[model samples]
Target: MSLGSSKELAENKIILLYMIDKVNMPVSNHHITKLVLENKFMNYFILQQFLNELCDSGFLELSENGGKSFYSITPNGKKTLEYFVNLIPFGIKSIIDNTIPEIRSDIKKESLISADYTPKSENEYIVSCKLKEDNFTLIDLCITVGTKSDARTICENWKNNPQQIYSEIIASLTRKRDKTNRDKDKDED
Candidate 1:
């Protein structure tokens, strides 16, 4: 959703700043949407609008190659994030305190799975397992892996048979161990 006006856009920047501070990394629009939804603070439209504003204001960078857009915090964005980190504690303390009860209730209803677990649904599982360090999700992971193929393979296996996916992931990592050892040996030589 597009942000309504300059004023609303400013509010979104504040929220995005808070999000960066909370997550400590570049966040994509998808991650921001999840946080907003999870916290019951705003809708997806507003979140997207806010992100666009931040991008326009030189506070964030958006990459376009992947299915998910990646947003990295700029130096200016970092400054804004820092300012909000300090400001929010006191400015919104009362509101935050009041919201805790509801937040807790929502948290109880939302299912959180670990990175290691296979997801029941393809979309839900990918959304859940994607790395959240800064604002990136599984879609970002797919982009970084250089193709949707790897992500699709993993997702397909995960959905069709979780056990098989787990075994494959384990085997893939085990193969990487030997490669790592070889790289280390070359370095030593």
Candidate 2:
């Protein structure tokens, strides 16, 4: 690459690290793509290349969950950005700082709820639902269904109503049952 192109590439890489660091959490690949495309920082293809390169260079960590990829800046990435953040233009950095809060909130909210399905056999599918906070998983549930449609429905319900479903599940599991007549009589005797 020419010097100009190399400089641009470095800036773009720094921008990705800066964004992930500012978000300060594991953000889904989809969200990162959306943020970059929405900001017109670079084209989709280029952004993907940068993400791959960052991961390869140990500047970012990648995790897979529910078939989605999430990215977080590595400590090395933060150190690098701290050293070369000046490569990014002032206005661009300002935009990033301003844009991060809303994106962070959205990422945090979305990361809490997850649902996915995988085929178990010709006629069976397993649906997985999860609720997570920070680094902890609050709930991880899986159910098998006879059909794909059923699995999809279950996944949707879990995603849409995880809180209510969690509450109901906990209540049912912990509910106190009245003593049986025989047990009560035996105790009295």
The best candidate in terms of TM-score: 2
* RMSD to true structure for each model, in Å: 12.8, 5.7
**Residue pairs clashing, model 1:** 1-45, 25-134, 27-135, 130-138
> Please, what is the whole-model Cα lDDT of each candidate in the order they appear?
0.54, 0.89
Instruction: Tell me the tens digit of each residue's lDDT in model 2 across 44-116.
Output: 8888988999999999999987567899999999999999999999988998899889998887777788889
Candidate 1 lowest-lDDT run of ten: 108-117
Model 1 bad stretches (over 4 Å): 1-9, 64-66, 84-154, 159-189
Question: Cα deviation of 145 in candidate 1 (Å)?
Answer: 22
Model 2 segments more than 4 A misplaced: 1-4, 63-68, 133-138, 171-189
For each candidate, how many residue pairs have backbone atoms clashing (under 3 Å)? 4, 0
**Candidate 2 displacement at residue 124 in angstroms:** 2.8
Look at candidate 2 and give me any clashing residue pairs: none
